[model samples]
Target: MHDTERMNSGEIRAGIGLALVFAFRMLGMFMVLPVLATYGMDLADATPALIGLAIGAYGLTQAVLQIPFGMLSDRIGRRPVIYAGLLVFAAGSALAAGADSIWGVIAGRVLQGAGAISAAVMALLSDLTREQHRTKAMAMIGMSIGLSFAVAMVVGPLLTRAFGLSGLFWVTAGMALLGIVLVVALVPKGTGALQHRESVVAGQAIRSTLRNGDLLRLDFGILALHAILMASFVALPLALVERGGLPREEHWWVYLTALLVGFFGMVPFIIYAEKKRRMKRVLGAAVAVLLFCELFFWQFGNSLTMLVIGAVIFFTAFNLLEASLPSLVSKVAPAGGKGTAMGVYATTQFLGAALGGILGGWLYQQGGLGGVFVGCALLCALWLVIAVTMREPPYVTSLRLPLSPTALRDAGLIQRLLAAPGVADAMVVAEEAALYIKVDTQKLDRTSLERLIESAPAMC
Candidate 1:
């Protein structure tokens, strides 16, 4: 591989540092998911509905603020935005730790979501890495999130068991502090925020991204996926304790088992989806799996063995969809509209979490675990229908290349790029002096594109 294709040590360091930042932040957010339902009831004035609100309150703020934070980074700088967000998160954690009531926990969760720094963090990662290696750097962040979630499921229960919910909140606050240290001491500074169309949302592109039918379907899909996940968790922990005969401390074993089995089970399907170019088919199948799991849980949740089976199946589908959805968004996104589409996608995802938490709590109060399961089943069914009807996504990856002034003026540049093997779409932004193209990497003729750039005529 060319040196350009490989990430240098600086890039590697940046990627690792940023990934840890993401992990720490996400871990703080996720560690409460499993414990809150069972333990949160002890808080004064706790109700199922209020407990659910507390669980998902952060998502509401996160959804609302993520885009603005990204834009803010462009103005004030990435590190400053990150530092401020993390501090806000720490403050929220402290508030929750000291609160004796469910309402206070909800307030804390909202504050936690206020630390909407994901976009800023991603923007910084883009600044620190080269275009060719950008995908790999982003992938590192994605993998860190997955790993943190898995760890959170196990650790949340253990921490809550040992130190209670207050202690858990305190720990999350400490983790947020640790994240600040990582940012200050380890993460390399970027030169400045660059308008990376592929990575940063453009305000003008929002309407167009929202209007895209395929992208909208994907947005709905993520919303539904997370909605189902949040709703299921609202009842799942209690079900495990009440019906599955599992003790609180042993809950980690269930998550650990389910995550392990589900992760391993999801690998081959992911391979099939990517290698066989069967993304739509696999995605629909996963939704169908989710629907089946919900129905299964509704019917057989009273039994320990059956609940475990349902969880394993649910996680298998959940992990697959989680891994696949972002890839689909990337593939379906317009040449220069990826950032906007993803911004919308992310917003919808958080909205789903908020809706799910509230809906799940209400349902749990109305009809207990069965109602929650039934509600999720309906959501899965709707997502499955949407998945089946969506258009097959083009299997292409976006690439951004700096354009020389001569090349920018070349009228035939786009046609030439589209003519290259595997090239599907091309756009040149004169203002930015950049060319954004989508290419099927498996068949892309890189040398031809390089030659065209190398041999471009000079201006008269």
Candidate 2:
């Protein structure tokens, strides 16, 4: 077979296509976060607590459905389910955009959140990319989301002026439509799509994800990350309008600056950590930064500069945690359950978000900044503890090997390949093959993989 046929994937290109779809949907969530509460107060029947509920309601639905939807994608089809979810989300956005009362907005927000597709996206990327490249593909989607969240914070207000609230929904609808086009035009077909079976546990993929301890740690990290995020937004907008002296129309600038500076600030350290194999240390430092920001918000958020300083630190750590957690999850998750693991992880994240908003509103109502900060600090502290204990996963690589029935009979080859140096684990699955090659990053020998494959092509 030719090199192209042997590859069985064009991971980098296909990964980009998948990342675009994810970025669009994240923009949908991020748009309202930085300004929603302050402006939302004008709607008839609005209340402080009611506004907080609205801020978090979307996550409630997303938390509930993320895993189920992902499992569904394994059965029905990724693109079709995603399309349906988008339609529901767009309809909900339109409903909120046109609402005359606070209740209407809440209802619409619920519908909009039902479009949650993060889990399905992860699963689909796993199906499409080779094992060695799967983590990279997942990283692409994660980075897209981080960049989108940062960009949207800065752009939402500017966009609001052009379209108004009604425009936000309409634009959301239009974005969904565009996403549908990408799904149709770009997403590569998956081999698993043809025989993706339905069962109580959805087979090995989900079973493995459920049993992983490392993945659980990462999951806890994400839960804390988003819980604090949604809770902060519940109060930040009001803080800005009241204490910062910023008009609602210009609030995006705060987000724009914080997101940009924080996003850029994180790059050097992230690269250093990843290259030097010091991920655990970097991650610990990031969590510490997040906790410090929470304390800063609690103590000195009496002025715009203080809020902005707090926001810069908050989002810098947020971006890192958002992207790194998934990559870390991939390292620990069971083979083929990339989707299910992410689904569970995302559900936890959304649940945290919903709880954050609900709890933040209640806390603010009763005890103000001290209550919220104490709660967020507890979350960060929990993650920091987990991060410190996390095992530094060796560089694990995945590969795809095409197989037919005839190849299954080549008995000893699979076992022999697994015994090779640097090969920690191997799964010579039918139709697809996976290997978790533990590598010394500084001295990886590509030739071993090639030589091993050449010696036992049929078994591989």
Q: Largest lDDT belongs to which candidate?
A: 1
Which window of 10 residues has the lowest lDDT sum in candidate 2?
194-203
Off by over 4 Å in 2: 1-18, 121-140, 185-202, 205-208, 403-407, 410-415, 431-444, 457-460
Question: lDDT by residue for model 2 over 290-317, one digit each (tens)?
Answer: 9998888888988999988888888888
After best superposition, candidate 1 residue 405: deviation in angstroms? 1.9
Residue ranges of candidate 1 with Cα displaced over 4 Å: 1-5
> Cα lDDT of all candidates, in order?
0.91, 0.72
Per-candidate TM-score against the hidden true structure: 0.98, 0.87
lDDT score, residue 414, model 2? 62
Worst 10 residues of 1 by lDDT: 445-454
Give the clashing residue pairs of candidate 2, or none. 131-398, 132-398, 132-399
RMSD of each: 1.2, 3.8
